[model samples]
Target: SGDLRIEMRDLAVFGEESERAARAVFAAGKQDEYWDYHNALFEGGEHRPKSQLDDDSLVSLGEDLGLDPMQFKQDMNSTEAHEQFDTVASEGQSIGVSSTPAFIIGGKPLLGAQPTQQFTDAVDEALARAES
Candidate 1:
């Protein structure tokens, strides 16, 4: 349940930064404040990390979402939290992932953060291959 889901490698940067934030949320998942933090960063239809993804913002999101402030902070910087994300990155690298949002369909490498139609087309092709 406290697992980090990553689809990229070269996490030297990710492991030390972005993943820390995500791990904090995942480890604190039991507090049920995940969605609130998630919504705060994403529901607005834009990720304004400059204003919404900082310590103050994270604290605000946790409180607004009804999570314990102390616990949220602890998990936010916990070594375990960072480690969880590191594992995800390592796994991704081992599996040939070099970027974010990469998908492996029918053993094919599909890179890039594209539109829904692009993904749909890939899925359709993968399904067709499986059927054949």
Candidate 2:
């Protein structure tokens, strides 16, 4: 096994519907299908011409994932889910994350599309710091 751990955070900056997507994904997380929903959104984002981040589309996505349709909508529209999205977005902004696909390795940020070797170097440096 490896010591590497990966965590995803919400930073809604893509479009008008991004905040809606964030809340929907948060709701999915509550049902323990966070990564599945997250991955589906990302994959869909790449191919879909029109934005699928609306409430109806979000609920449909949950239904496809076997989540309760009504419950998913309820959770997605709940005040708590919105607050959670706001909190994470605020936290990311406080830490200087302002864009999609940003990475923070060892407390140092790597912003925007980067090469694989760059990530390798960053991880190696992070591991070195941890070991030292």
Q: All candidates' TM-scores?
A: 0.65, 0.88
Per-residue error (Å), model 1, residue 14: 5.9
Q: Global lDDT of each model?
A: 0.63, 0.86
lDDT of 2 by residue, 1-132 (tens): 475888888777876588888888899988999889888877855733345778899899989998888889999999999889889888888889999789989888899999999999999999999999
What stretches of model 2 exceed 4 Å from their correct place?
44-51
Candidate 1: C-alpha lDDT: 0.63
Span of ten consecutive residues with least summed lDDT in model 2:
44-53
Residue 42 of model 2 has an lDDT of: 77
| Span of 10 residues, lowest total lDDT, candidate 1 | 2-11
* Predicted candidate 1 versus true structure: per-residue lDDT over 28-113, tens digit per residue: 57476565665564566764555455676776677777788888887777776667777877776777877655777666767768
Superposed by TM-score, candidate 2 places the C-alpha of residue 55 at a distance from the truth, in angstroms, of: 0.7
Best by TM-score: 2
Query: What RMSD, rounded to one decimal, does every model reach?
Result: 5.6, 1.9
